[model samples]
Target: MTLNASLLKQGAACGQEGVPPPPLLLSLLDSSHHILCVSHVSPDGDAVGSLLALGSILRAQGKRPTLALQDEVTSEFQFMPGAEKIIGPAEVAHSYDLIVCLDTSSIDRIGTVYIPEIHNQIPLVVIDHHVTNTLFGTDNWVDTGCAATCQMLVRLADALGVPLSEEIAFSLLTGLVTDTLCFRTANTDTNVLQAALRLVNAGASLEFVVRNTLDSRSLGLVRLWGVGLANVQMEEGIIWATLNAESRQRSGVEPHQSDGLANFLVTVREADISATFAQRFANNGQELIECSFRAKPGFNVSQVAYSFGGGGHPPAAGCTVSGSLQEVSARVVAALRELRRQSVDGDSG
Candidate 1:
């Protein structure tokens, strides 16, 4: 069933009160038959949740949907009902009626899974919640005001007249909880809570999702954080840390285990901005530093990340730089300091 304008507007405004969905988004979905859905590389909770939720919703509507991701679904999220259905790039077909890209800011974020040469003929739909989104789709529904892409999908489900099933509700709620840190982020509003409440009422276990996502972490991850904290630094209201490959090895954790260190560093009482620089090797064996940034309320780190060719929300963002950890850290820390300086000066002005 096609969503009327009123329903589209209501669904789009699910989180932001009066905002509306793109005029053509609902129509695009209505017209499509087979769809291929993909999220970003290094799939996070929001990415996986939105991808699986949308896939489930489409299946309920009698459409064939293929869910693809460039990275593996980390063990933390594998318990979700449809996690096993996700396929890698090697498994993707060359044809689809449409391509729905979820939670990704730019086309490149899909990695090699999206082949422009093969998939270019398909209508590309971009659904995301990143403030730094590049608007790189034939049809784009980017709602930066929404806390997570899954929040946007909650609206989409409403538009499609699909009631949230138990699986869909659980997946969507996982995204909302992890992205908002259980409604503790600054962007958490009545609408976010309302969406979450709906999911809870639909049988999503808030306690279960919390226990699996935010409240749970491996001992190795805790050790990684300890190593990261040992080298932490703070200057001009900015806190920073570095996690080298050796530190990852010493902690007996994978590279992504250091992901939460920046978030932890941002909790420092005196700091408004936090950053983590991690040493990694590229496919070509070249050394690189992955930079993750997080800002407290009223500060935006997305622009800084955008300047380095990465994208994200105001409160959290990231970019990868090709350089030694020390060099990249020094350079990025200076840039973050400048960003903090500008924001502080602008606030006082």
Candidate 2:
């Protein structure tokens, strides 16, 4: 169980000298025979991509690896190589030699797949790239400076001596591309581009991954966007939209289909922060508001999300709050405005 103290990128000095040494990450994988790999619920591309790529890497070592996700993979990501192999919570095994959590920030992010009462006894390794990571695993490899966890895995494969195969290359490249929004994110550094290039050289099609991920969207999502944008609100540099049950029903879209709205709203030139509030119903039939937030480079929404029991990077974050869509949206928008005010004040000072 080792924790990397800093970033781990190929060709750059990681400067990570933590207790138990960094090589133990590989040792954990090598010593384990049967492994369980899981990612966050409502997995984005990075989550699904990292899960599949890790399975391929483990299989290369002749180890049996099972990939599990709390929810089903979206239609757009179903085309990813080996995506059909991903299992749901019910299909997960009772035991495994080791558990690898990828692209997940905390234990709860793995959702119902991890029953802490029994599974806590087993060794756990967390591989993620988020500033808000709780470092819940026995072995935590959190590289906040890295753009995506998939980029860190590129260096991990090099250390483990696993040559990038076509399947692995496709999966890893998709994670890199989607997380960085096809290299349009603020964190798209030289290291990120070089990693994408290496993956492309290893037989991944950049254009193909882009077309399937960033360039594609469902018609339902477009309809939902139309509903959200019709009543978009802005105040003190914070712009936001609320999607209640009526809005969703009117647009004929589900909750998951409303994801890209926040990303779209944040593009407004006058808005430094943007948010999308979607209404949801819990299993117990209680109302829950799912809040997705985005920020410009100088504004951070992660801490605000963390304050509300959610986690993500500085530019993008989210949370699930219990309240009506209007209540939650108003509260979160006020918080975002304050955050922007403080950020601007600090910069001026």
Per-residue lDDT for 54-73 in model 1, tens only? Answer: 99999999989999998889
Could you tell me the lDDT of residue 287 within candidate 2?
A: 93
The per-residue C-alpha lDDT of model 2 at residue 146 equals 78
**Per-residue alpha-carbon lDDT of model 2 for 217-277, expressed as tens digits?**
8787788888889989999999998888777867666675576888888899999999999
Q: Rate the local accuracy (lDDT) of all candidates.
A: 0.86, 0.84
The TM-score obtained by model 2 is 0.93
Per-residue lDDT, model 2, residue 185, is: 91
TM-score between model 1 and native: 0.94
Q: Distance (Å) between predicted and true CA of 318, model 2?
A: 0.8
TM-score of each: 0.94, 0.93
lDDT against true structure, model 1: 0.86
Clashes of 1: 0
Model 1 misplaced stretches (Cα beyond 4 Å): 1-18, 250-252
